[model samples]
Target: MSAWIAAAGQALLIALLAPIVTGVTRAVRARLEGRAGGRIAQPWRDIRKLLRKPPTSPEGAGVFFSAAPVVLMSTSLLIAATVPFVSTAGIAGSADLIVVVGLLLLGTVALALAGLDTGTAFGGMGSSREMTIAALVEPTLLLAVFALSTRVGTTNLGVIVAAGASDPAAVFTPASLLAFAALAIATLAETARIPVDNPSTHLELTMVHEAMILEYSGRDLALVEWASAMRLAILLGLLANLFAPWGVATGTTWTAVVIAAAVLTVKMCGLATLLAAAEVYAAKLRLFRVPELLAGSFAMALLAVLTSYILA
Candidate 1:
């Protein structure tokens, strides 16, 4: 298969699987808590219902408010198109670490700006908190990936993953373990998961992501929610492939691509299951203590970098 075809396939697969991944987490959490969760397709139903409604904007909301959802969705689609989830043969030169990181940041900033544009106290407060956490989160994301880049000798995600596939031992090293831990924590913060921010919480004081989107309604809200789900799926996909790329496609065979896609789904669902279990046992840290958690992740990422360099 051509790289472009592979990329398109990967994007579509991720898009379709994003909602299911979210539902899996919620259902798993519900099961662990002794409640029968709704169907695994509940997120898809909620999104479809939201899309059928008309979008409403807050009074005095400007371009940022109207444009943020599109911007967020577009950035996510772009990342999904470029990132090699199923096949390592991504768009030529499009999966650079800096570029992917920048895309993630762009979506993040767009949402933050939208939150601020609402002129609500909660919006501003959430934006402030998001930026603070982002300041710490972004660096750890880079450093954790940087640790892998050192061993691969390039910052391209496709290259790093391909290298991991060829040398499985390298992926199981001390450096890889530290980087995985750091990225795992950063993913939790980025996705507003437990121990960072509670996705199901409605309490104003406890809400982080929900606060920013409180003013959104209808299709605008749908886009934001869809994009958030996609972001979580993408990050989990990244985590799965980065540390355990055993089944990722490295060739141009269509069969390999199909098998790889199946493998990506399995990995993402497995990770989501583990994440839900962790959330069940984990309590949300206090607002003031969030930075300390991020600090610990950052330290691990830094050490991963140093460890990779020294080991090399």
Candidate 2:
């Protein structure tokens, strides 16, 4: 019961702090660009303002349009609940890496469908681009998971974390390093960061994810935006905790949990800063160049898998 309570608390924390992570990234980017940024809690204010108003749907849109935000937000919450954050103590089932990947893909598909249901040209184009990226990226994501799972002989994230904890040096290996690189690239692409799709861009021709959600307004927009931020935080948390499983609690020790939380915050901040730096220094890729990015990620993931097999 206590474990379940802890899990629930962590889930809520993830939902709430997700926006802060997004804000931090934005602030870092602003600073890098030599401009003063909004407060770290700016996203919270935006969300609050959004929730106070009713959504306005396009005149011709139907029920699917109304259901889209609910689906998007719900899927993100489900994913957050399933993922092992502070501890694996009370999660309903084993946190399998494949299952995690599948949940994420499911959420992406839901968003894409929502985009298509709107019947807007930009929404359709966004959905098409999103699907194309997903199709190209999934193989790499799976391959990277396969490499790590094969090394630990389990697809369960908790088990993999435990194995790595027992042998910390294992993370320094070439295979793990390569897999991290591949996952990092996939994370950026999946999260719609710069050099992939600029999160802040409103340009119709260049916008991918933003284009799809352009029609969403008020609370619907808030839900979608919050969900995206949560997804980003969850992905970065997984990358940090899974690859570098240091300072994470294994049991219900309060002191250990506190330390773990601190470490988690620090790691997430570093990742957010790094992402901001990348976005600041890089330009968004041409639409046609996206496949090349995915292909490189796929190759690196494949190499990681091969290296793991050879090392074994």
Candidate 3:
């Protein structure tokens, strides 16, 4: 019961904090570009306004169109629940890292299907680009996961973090460092961030994710947007907790839990700043060049795995 409560609280905390992270990243990017951006509270306001409006389905849209956003949001929540934020323990019993990756893919697949269902040129184009990117991303993501899992001798996320927490230096090896780099790149691609797919772009030819949901409006759009934010937060949290799980609480004591939460928040903010800085200085790659980026990430993952074997 205690575990259940902790898991619920942590999941809720993530959902609530996700928007703030998105807002901060946006504000930071704007500031770097010499513009006075909207306040950090802007995302919350946008979501609330969106929620008050009615959702409109695209012409010829089927039930899948309506269901896709819900599935995406649910999968994001599931991913959040599986990750260890405040504690190494999670609510789900089979919350393996592979399962987490699979869920992330599932959400992407659903969104792609929804895009195709809309039968618009932009939607089809986005779906094609998205699937192409996904094809290159999943293998790299899996390889990175295998690198870490092989080192820890377990696929369960909680166990991996707990093990890393036990021996923090073990995560500083060549394999670990390489895996982190690979996963970090994969995260940028997976989240539709700049240099892969710019989140702020509306150019139909360049948009990957935005084109898919271009027809969605009102509450559905809000949910999709919120879910996107949560997914980003969860992925960065996973990267942080997996590679730097030193401060994560392994016990159920209140003081430990509080300290764990505080550390997690700091890590997230630091990562957000890094991402914003990277985005500010980076230009979005041409659609064709994205495959090369993913290929490089895959090579990194391959090296990380090889290093893990040689060092082990």
Candidate 4:
């Protein structure tokens, strides 16, 4: 009972803090570029303003077009609920890493469908690019999971984290390092960040993600934006806890949970700051070049898998 409550609380916490983490990244990037950026509350303000406006849909839109934002947001929440963020435990049967990977792909597919449903050129283009990237990233993501899971003999996220927590030094091995690199690239691509895609750009010619949401307005746009932030938070949290599960709480006690939450915050902030710094210095790759980068990441993940097998 307590574990379930803790899992719920962790999900709610991720949902709430997700936007703030995004805002922090924006602010840090702005400062690095010598501009006084929007406040840390900017994302929240944007969401609230969008929600207050009336939602608009395209002519001849179907149920999927209208429900896409809800599906994206719900899937992000579902992923958060199942992953080991503050604690290693979640609702029974949903805590498996394979299930988490499936949920991530589901969110991607849902967005791609919504993009295609609009029937606009930009929508079609974005959907094509997103699906292309998904095809390349998903396999690497699964292989990275396989790299880590092979060592522990379980695909359950809780067990993986428990194993890492018990032996933190084991996470520094060649296989884990390669998997981390692959996962980091996938995270950047999945979250629509730089070198693969730029989240801040609205230029349709160069934009991949923003192009898809071009037709969304008001509350629908709010949900999509919020979901994007949540997805970024969830992925970064997983990278932090799974690769370095040292500070996460294995038990569901209040004291342990509190400490776990604090440590997770620091870890997340560190990763977000590092990512922002990277984005500030790096330029977005041409759309044609994205596949090359993803292919390289896939190769790295394949190597990680082989390394894990040989080491075992």
lDDT of each: 0.90, 0.83, 0.87, 0.87
User: Which 10-residue span in candidate 4 carries the lowest summed lDDT?
Assistant: 89-98
Q: Against the hidden reference, what TM-scores do the models get? A: 0.97, 0.96, 0.97, 0.97
Candidate 4 residue-wise lDDT at 34: 96
Compared to the true structure, candidate 3 yields what TM-score?
0.97
Model 2 regions lying over 4 Å from their true place: 170-172
How many clashes in each candidate?
A: 0, 0, 0, 0
Give lDDT tens digits, candidate 1, residues 1-312: 777877777788888899999999999999999999988999999999999999998899899989999999998988998887887774822598888889899998998999999999999988999989999999999999999999878899988888888986664468888999999999999999989999999898988888899999899999999999999999999999888888988875888888988898999999999999999999999999999999999999999999989988
Q: Residues 132-217, candidate 2, lDDT per residue (tens digit)? A: 99998778878876778778777887777766777866533678878898888899988999899999989898989997888899
User: Model 2 — TM-score against the truth?
Assistant: 0.96
Superior candidate under lDDT, 1 versus 3 = 1
Which candidate number would show the highest lDDT if scored against the true structure? 1
lDDT of 3: 0.87
Q: List residue ranges in candidate 4 displaced over 4 A.
A: 90-94, 169-172
